[model samples]
Target: MKTDLKLNVLSVGNTSTGSRSLPSQFAEPIRPDLVKRAVEAIQGNTRQQHGSKKEAGQRHSAKLSRRRRDYKTSYGHGISRVPRKILTKRGTHFSWVGAVAPGCVGGRRAHPPKPIKIWAKKINDTERRKAIRSALAATLVKTLVAQRGHHVPPQYPFLLENKFEAIAKTRDVIEALEKLGFNDELNRSSEKILHAGRARRRGRGTRRKKGPLFVVSNTCSLIHAVQNIPGVDVVPVHQLNVSLLAPGAHIGRLTLFTEGAIERLEKEKLFMQEYKNLHPPVPPAPQSPASHSKLQNPSNTQKQSQPTQQKTQQPSALQPQKKVSPTKAPSTKSKPASQMTLTQLTK
Candidate 1:
């Protein structure tokens, strides 16, 4: 006997059950652990590296000194009376051992080594597939259960549906949803889908392209769409804490076209237009003169006539040039503090 799991078509939130109008297979109970593992695996696969810090050793040079000599006396003093045996260099003091002579103690190391993780874990194929399926099932079930029993804001809905119409472009997606019996008003902008949560890969292909999608107006429509597709999962954007939407029923493409839905869509468009008007205009892109040869060099016909050129250059020619005087530089005689101004003395 084919073991029957009544799967509470409605309780499961499949479109066939009427909770959501999307695909039907999504209306089953999904395991949370499986969903979590699937998400983790995807995240692991998409993990980005900081890239190696090959220049870290060079950065350490800024923190340490680079002097070779050790004594301060090496720099000739004003007086010759100082003993030649005195071992001071120009920059270093008597106490400084670094500059005393050729063979001296070395300075401290600029950078020290630190410990960090360098390896990532690889998830098994069987576990990944199981997790994705579980997450989708959980999402649909939660939506069906919440529709009547629990109340939440329409704008901040319980689940965020990410539909990939299999048919490319946004218009086709909207049409598909309408055909599935959802109202146009129920559909939100594509931007909302990105904000709510990102789409998860079905694991078969690395390059999964989104055709066109929008949020389902009713939970019934949403579940139906999800239940149909394999490997796809949906969960409430705000709370990853709950169920997942399942896909296996092979639900067909959806579209929206119910009564009064057009009016709602117009209002949404108006609101978007008004919001766009409030934003400042984007500045024009900077054009590269070198890339366009015509822009760099003007036509000879447009050049100023010889008479006009002479007129423009006359004033510049007549202007008297200032002669830079060869004033003798001041001798290096030290002035007494009393002779200096208050500012000079303070400095």
Candidate 2:
């Protein structure tokens, strides 16, 4: 008789068992009702923390005022005087204190101050603990034995692998995990986890000494796309912090799938960057005539052409001056001859 007994080989926060396969115990039949109940129980057990008391209610209070008139009447003429029927009238035995109105000095208070309303919602201890455990158990059971291209039983289901860790900022960590066959199909929301938290001192500088961590999100974006094997967390490894990576912080053991995915992502990223650097964008061939002109007429070319133009202008000006001087010489000679002829005629 082939009997199916459940085995617990994978321990959370423990070292890798180095075994590639499940211990055959997780292959037992699944109970959908049990899983549903577990999900409900886990959800019901979640605890939401409350804010500060001062922030819970409005601080400034509204002010209120009150005034009242006395019913008893006092009699008076143009001159001050007490009426005969007044409480303080002559021969009246009533006390003056009793006749005083409420809210007056030594009188009873009309309205006392009121307290403002304040309330808060809180979670119970038992429910919170139960929820955490149930969620973990559910994740563990589904990830261990499920297979790709096969119907995943609730007790032993596998998830398909695709772009589960695509959104991680650290490509190195994400690609490393993808190379390992440990992704699972859990229908929940997915998210990219960032690295932030307390640091622990290692040998030299401060480091996240808590070992490693895996983050499973409640996002459904990559749930069914990846081979739903149970071990891959879509989150990057470098983003985790010491507090989150501490012993007992995560739900299961840290596997090489995560490490391998990160490595692959790093390599791919490097290769892409190298390819981009090696094949830089070629500048567009100078299309504008203005740019071409600027390049061809560099400083030396401009200086050479300017000197030649100046030399041509200088020769032209000199030739015109030389022709004008010769014509002026002939005019001077003709003027002297005309003056001599006039002198001889007068003699």
Residue 269 in model 2: lDDT: 34
Query: Clashes in each model (backbone N, CA, C under 3 Å)?
Result: 55, 33
Task: List model 1 lDDT by residue over 1-347, tens digit each.
Answer: 11222221111121332222322223334565665555555555556644434443233222212333433343443332222232343534432223212232332323433334433456665565455434434433435424322221232122222333233443543454444433332332111322222333443333321211222322334434554332223322222211222112211211221212222322332112122333578998987766466566656336665554344534366688768899999899979988989998778
How many clashes in candidate 2? 33
Model 2 over residues 59-176: C-alpha lDDT tens digits?
Answer: 2221111222323322221222221222242442322322122323333334432233223323443333233333333334434312212223332322222233343334433343
Question: Model 2, which residues run further than 4 Å from truth?
Answer: 1-120, 143-169, 181-347
Best by TM-score: 1
- What's each prediction's TM-score? 0.30, 0.20
lDDT of each: 0.35, 0.32
TM-score of 1: 0.30
